[model samples]
Target chain A: MILAVCLNPALDVTYAVTALRPGTSVRVRSVQRRAGGKGVNVASVLHQQGVAAIVTGPAGGSAGTDLTAGLDSAGIGHRFTPIAGATRQTVAVVDADDATVLLEPGPVLTNAEWTAFTTSFADLAHEADVVTMSGSLPGGVPGDAYGRLIGLAHAAGTRVILDCDGSALIEALHDAPDVVKINEHEAASTTGIETDSAEGVFAAAEELHALGAKEIVITRGAHGVAARTGQGRFASTPAGTVDGNPTGAGDAFTAGLAAAMAAGLDWPARLRRASAWAAAAVAIPTAGAIDPGVATDHETRTIVQELPA
Target chain B: MILAVCLNPALDVTYAVTALRPGTSVRVRSVQRRAGGKGVNVASVLHQQGVAAIVTGPAGGSAGTDLTAGLDSAGIGHRFTPIAGATRQTVAVVDADDATVLLEPGPVLTNAEWTAFTTSFADLAHEADVVTMSGSLPGGVPGDAYGRLIGLAHAAGTRVILDCDGSALIEALHDAPDVVKINEHEAASTTGIETDSAEGVFAAAEELHALGAKEIVITRGAHGVAARTGQGRFASTPAGTVDGNPTGAGDAFTAGLAAAMAAGLDWPARLRRASAWAAAAVAIPTAGAIDPGVATDHETRTIVQELPA
Candidate 1:
């Protein structure tokens, strides 16, 4: 079973309007809301792919109740610890011209809350074959929260997938998680490199692998994903841009990678499968959903190149 | 007790940012969510003023749950009819420079839900001394819903305080409610008058009274209020601008007016107390709250010029 951890969950709200202007009230055309966070999104993708996955984290207040109830409605297994504070929300005001996202800084986790979550996570990790820790920790949570969780998962003989940035990602690297996945911006920020080319992205990956992660995956929006593992270094790109909303492409890739790893696929095959799911994500309007049989019907000639280490 | 009806209840989510820019992500500096709608705001102001009141309307889904829970947390009384669709959210992206409010047209109420709510409202109206029907009707609810409610309230011997705009206002006016309160813009829209001046507002109030409302009240932002009753035509203005968040000033005024009406105050005193409440509302950070002693000490040299009708 795959376990996805979202330390900071949110009620993702999307407001559609004909146009947005300053100093005036805009009549909203429509609104869509859903439970969200990188890990929760990954679990959503897993459930859609007919993979068994459980979503867990710190949830509380009415928003938390909504998030858990939403998960139940979606048929995704979840066990979120109830905390004192309300979960956060991410709002996107979309018009024909653009989509403006407002991300709220989540609730601050008290020491006791973090400790309780840690105990619960360790027990769940023991029963999981693959554990994916995604998203940033909320305020008051130690930056090394994922690193600490990695240690617990390792002790339970579970393979860990770390997907985050900043101090959290840096801290988790010290434990050498099985896979570290990130987007171009996070990769560039980590290495201070303009990863606009394959060489630059490969340079960032080398740095990540050297830091401790056994395998590294770097996703480039329309350009697809590049990876480095003990077997070799490879990059794959879909034939062309599969445009829609690319918000959860990376999370879908992570879910695909986890599925591939659990299925004991070879390193190159893992990249191909991950790319298929990422492409599927881009072809959809929402983040956590894919076109019917996107991965199965993925006939796109994704060019895979074996880059030198 | 005052029964405030908010047909389209909302979770008012305010996101404060250093600045707002479209097509990019903004990190929210703070988030504040409250149960909101015209009647809800009126009820909140009454609660703050130590007035007995109960709020009710159609509520459902997660946003509804959040709204009701927030109302409970705020110590306000509410009974909402549950429905299948979620209640809507109105988001305000506030910055130091400007506040952009996005108002969502709430859920499409099924015929069954509307009937259930109408039944519930009639029962409550019978017990209410005054029924304040405010806000816009949600989708799937007929434009004359408030008019129908006014009819029900009248049958139940409840004095109706109508506050709305467009077709709803026109329809409710036909029911000849006890009082009709509205902001200058709404008054202007209803009567085709540019009510930016005291004379213009008074003219609009006269038109409303002629249209069958026993009494008329028109709020002019920081400029204060003007009224027309059987006894006389009167106007009151704050000495100067009482600047802050003016979002709830109208609601506060409605509450003050309802309280004065319930206390059987004279027309001039009712206008004065209502103006004081509105001014006090502007001095505070939020809409439904007033600065303590402002109403008592509102020595704001308000000149009440008795207008000739």
Candidate 2:
């Protein structure tokens, strides 16, 4: 079983409005709440694809209860370490024009809570085929927390996938994860590259790989993704712009990659599956995962164009 | 014991910022979440004043759980009737200039849920000295739902205080509540008089009293309040401008009035106490009730000037 750890999970609330007028009250046409955080999102997507995954993280207060209940209802196994403070909430106000203003950086967690979470993580990693550590560390958690988890997962003989940004990503890279997934901007920030072109992104992925990541996957919204492994490099693009929402496309991509690897698929096949899931996720209105029906059709129709290595 | 019902209670979130810029992200300096909705605020204030009040209403989802927890921690008695939908949340983005943009009209309530709430209201009214119905009825609830609740409270020999606006307030007034607390705008809208002058407000109050309300209290911010009872009419002005957040001043006034009447205080003393509470509530940063330490001194120093009979 794959184990996903989200250090800073949140109660994600999305409000769809006709328009977001500043300093004026606008009625929300629709509102949805879901369990959020990169690791949680990855576990949810895997569950959608008929894979059993356990999601572990620090969850507290009423929001934590709701998150647990949501995961249970979705048939995703989860073990949450209860903390003192309430779980954070991220509000996404999506306007008619598809512009989203995200209120993020939720609640803080204490050092003792972080120690408790790491202890829980160690126990869960032992029973997992792969361990994915995702999202930012909450306040009071050490900056190198993810790096420590990567080392712990490696010691447990489990493949580790790191999906985070900023200083945490930099620190984790030193520990050498099996796979690292980052978006275009994070790739640029970490590699000090400015352009978002395929060549520039590929060069950045090479830099990341040299920095200790065994494999690097760069997600370019709308343009698909580029992955570099020891075997070679491959690029895949979706059939078309299946427009809906792109809130959790990256998480979906990570889930697809993990699922394909768990099934012993080759690198190219994994790229195809990941691209398909990411496309489907973007086309779905929901935040975290696409429906199985949509994921299946998208996977079948997805086209991967391998780049010359 | 007093029972307050908030059909559309909310998790009132206030974010204080330097200046609110549209289409741009802003970091909030301070954040506060309180048990909101007029009825919930009333119950909180009454509880702070050492009054035994039970708050009952529809609460569901994580937001509802937070409200319940807040009331519980504050030692306020409450029983929440679980509903299928989550309670609404109101976000106030307050700038340094003291200007606020309010997002109101929270979540919708189903008809079956509304009926269930009325049943709960009736049960609570049987043991309550006064039943206070507050806030806007959520979508899907009939406008006459408040009227039905008022009638039920009356049948139980409980004095009813109706604090709402628009059609809900209009419908409840037809059922003749014991007291009606409204802002100047709500008073004008219900009575069809647009003047902000005291005499104009008094004319509107007289019209509302004729509609069967025993007492009408119109709160004019900074200008104190205008009250009309069966004995006579009196308007009181605060000695100075108590500059602070005024989010729950009306609710504080309602709490003070309810507590006084429940203790059999005379109309003049009740009005004075209510004004003091309102002043104290506004002078505090957070909404709803004031701290007892501050409230006591404010209540003593409050200068209440009586208008002509």
Candidate 3:
């Protein structure tokens, strides 16, 4: 079973409005609330793909209770460590024209709560085959907390996937992970390499691989993704770009990669599946997971090109 | 004892922001939530004035829970009738300059719930000396529900003070309430007498009184208030107007008038106390209640001018 950790979770509230006028009242046509955090999204997607995955995180207050109910309704297994503070809420105001205004930065977690969460994290990792650490650390959580979890997963004989950025990602690289899926910007910031070309991206990925990552996947929206493994390097672009919502494409890719790896697929196949899932996700508005039939169709026809190492 | 019924209560949330920009995320600097509804405000102000007042209303959901807790913290007695639907919330965006944009039309109550509320209304009125029916009726409630409440109170020997406008006020007048407090606009709308002058306002109040009201009190913000009683007509203006929030001035005036009448104060004295409370309320940022000390000071020097009937 796969386990995912979302250190900072949020109650995502989406408000659909015909038009938003400043300093004026607008009627909300509809509202939807869901549990949202990168790891939660990834685990939810994995569950949708018929994979056994459990999501663990910190949750509190009425908003947190609603988030737990939401995860249960979606059939995503979850265990939340109770915190003293209320769970943070992210408000997304979506207009008729599909424009979105996201108000984020949810509740802050204290050190005692962070410590309690880590205990749950250790237990979940001990029982899982693959452990994925996703999203930002809440306040009071150490920046290197993800790295500590990576170390714990390694000792437990669980494969680790690091899906975070900046300092946290940099620190996690010190303890080599099986895979690191980062966007182009995060990759540049971590390696301090200017990636203006495919070669530059590959060079940055090599630098990260040297630091400890066994494999690196850099996703470039619309331009496709580049992956570097011990076998070699590969690049894949979607057949055609689709105009759609791009909110949860990366999480979809992470879910696809983890599922492929769990199925014992080789590095090349995993990259191909990840790219296909991401492209299909971009075609749909919802995050992380798409229909299995759509994902299969997109994967079967996706063109993953071999790039010279 | 006085009873105030806010059939349609709300958790009024005011978000203070630097400025409101359309289609952009805004960081709310401060958030203030209060128990809100016309009758609830009046009850709170009366409680602050050391009067024995109880607030009864329909409250549900988390927002309702917060409102109940707030009223309890303020030492105000209340009984909430739980309903199927959640209590509505009104969001006011107050900019740095204190300009407010109000969102209206709170939650809709069910028909069965409205019946239950009316039942509670009669029981409360039967035990009270005066009943003040305030605010707009939520959807599913008949516009004449206030009229029905006035009839119930009148039959119970409880002096009914109606502080609403439009159809509700007009409908309540058929019951001949002991007192009706309306602004210039509501008086003009109900009586079809333009209020361009004090005579016009008094003419509108006279028409409402003839329609069955025992007394009429018309409040003019900053300019003070005018009242017409069987004894005669009295007008009182503040010595000097202070610039502050005017959100709850009218409700404060109602509370002051109710308190004076309950104490058997003369018409001129009642008008003086009511105007002073209204002025002090407008000078404070929050609605309804004034500081006890401020109210005491204002009562000492408040001036009343008798007008020829």
Top candidate on DockQ is 1
> Which digits, one per residue and each the tens of the lDDT, describe model 3 over residues A1-309?
888888888888777777766656766666667888888888888898789999898888656887898998988999999987667666666776654444444567788888888788888888887887787877677778888888878888889888988888888888888889998888898889977788888888999998889989898776778889877888877756656777778888888888888888987788778877777677778775665655787687667777776
lDDT of 2 by residue, B100-198 (tens): 444544667777888888888888899998788888777878778888888999899999888887778777777898888898999898779874898
Models sorted by TM-score, best on top: 3, 1, 2
lDDT winner between 1 and 2, please give it. Answer: 1
List all candidate RMSDs to the true structure.
Answer: 3.2, 3.6, 3.0
Cα distance off (Å), candidate 2, residue B140: 4.7
Sort by DockQ, best first.
1, 2, 3
Model 1, A107-163: lDDT tens per residue?
A: 888999999999999999999989999988898788788989999999999999889
Candidate 1's C-alpha runs over 4 A off are: A183-185, A191-207, A218-227, A232-245, A292-294, A297-309, B183-185, B193-207, B219-226, B232-245, B299-309
Provide DockQ values for all models, in the order shown. Answer: 0.67, 0.37, 0.35
Candidate 3 local lDDT, B11-80, one digit each (tens): 8877777776656677766666788888888999898878999988788766687789889988999988
Report the C-alpha displacement of residue A184, candidate 1, in angstroms: 5.5
The per-residue C-alpha lDDT of model 3 at residue A271 equals 77
Q: Could you give the interface RMSD of each candidate, to one decimal?
A: 1.3, 3.4, 3.9
Give the alpha-carbon lDDT of every model.
Answer: 0.85, 0.81, 0.80
TM-score of 1: 0.89
